[model samples]
Target: MPSDVSRSSARPGGSATDLAAVWAVFTDMYEAYLAGDRARIDAHLDPEATVWDSATPQLLLGKPALDQVRAQRPAAERAGGGPVEAGLTAYDQVIDVFGELAVCRHWLRIDYRDRPSGLLRNTAVLRRAHGGWLITHLHEDGQAAD
Candidate 1:
């Protein structure tokens, strides 16, 4: 039911250009998080989107919910005793575009305190909203395979 050309265009790694915008925004988000820039994170994330892939698996929906996440950053930092230094080891991202909807799968290796030596793979789905993109849903799993 689909033409070959269409199929080709829809492939995950179809064209580098096709994924540039989303990837840039996603990268920006990651940088903001790393820098502990709550304002920047809030600015990019949709008010109604949900962040589901945390250790607590939070369902952060609506502006208030997102703001709560922003608020929790400092508290979490305090709880953890200090700032976390994380470095990405591997990132294999796949972006699927369907008009204004996009889904991204990011396999990342994060260095955190609890598991300072293992890699965790996180998958996040984003959507285009209000002239920008926002993370709509996320699911992360800790992997020992690394």
Candidate 2:
């Protein structure tokens, strides 16, 4: 996490603190993606993590599947003749923490290749394990591009 980012007032075991931590993790994950640092992204994902993205019909299950997709990212980015610029901005975020589990819901605007790709509503479930927060499941619904 960036040292400059403001810390939430919520305590470690409290929902607010957990929510802030989740947001920090989310930010770090995307920053890693933008930098093409798959290892960093992988570090934040649980072994049995799953994801459903708007671009694919099949569900992504486990690290292997996720890694396969990430492996292709470089080739895909080459289409843009360099690193693809990507970012995720979240809104209407709601977070709930239950012990070591946390669920976050938010509306997101994702930009890819320097332009807005889509608006998505997402729910991500994370668990605190291996001494840090790791994403366990993610479900995303595609919305009309804005």
Candidate 3:
């Protein structure tokens, strides 16, 4: 279980509402990814967002890189096929906001029905725009799941 469900910020200018919304952006994006909802996932991503995923070899930037990764999903998945079911959970979340920018760091555990679960050490940088938040950058490294 994650402690980020509740927000109590000690940093100046970082409010509970901001913390919750920032955390929500992380969860919301993963939920969309698991559900194969590309539109929803893109909704949370900044137009110029960059991501270094747990399995990727190089940093991915902008729309072209994003599209190429989507096209290369087959290479990343199982030889037979993809996961039949999967559940994503997070813990040890630290969310902070400074004006229009926020940083969210968390341990993400992804449980697959038959495949080995993946643990992600992730940091997401988000920018608040038009009353909402979009992921500006994401850095992630894979770890052995216990």
lDDT of 3 by residue, 41-117 (tens): 89999989999976678899986898888777785463436665478887777777888899888888988888888
lDDT of 2 by residue, 1-146 (tens): 23222333222345655667787777787678667687888888888899896656779999888667756666646455643456666666666777888877767777777555778888889998865689999888999986
* Clash pairs detected, candidate 3: none
Q: Write the per-residue lDDT of candidate 1 for residues 1-35, one digit (tens) a residue.
A: 11112222235443554466666665676677677
lDDT-sorted candidate list, best first: 3, 2, 1
TM-score of each: 0.70, 0.76, 0.87
| Candidate 1 residue runs with Cα over 4 Å from true position | 1-15, 66-76, 112-115
Task: Please give the lDDT score at residue 13 for candidate 2.
Answer: 46
Residue 78 in model 3: lDDT = 32
Q: Give the TM-score of candidate 1.
A: 0.70
lDDT of 3 at 128: 93
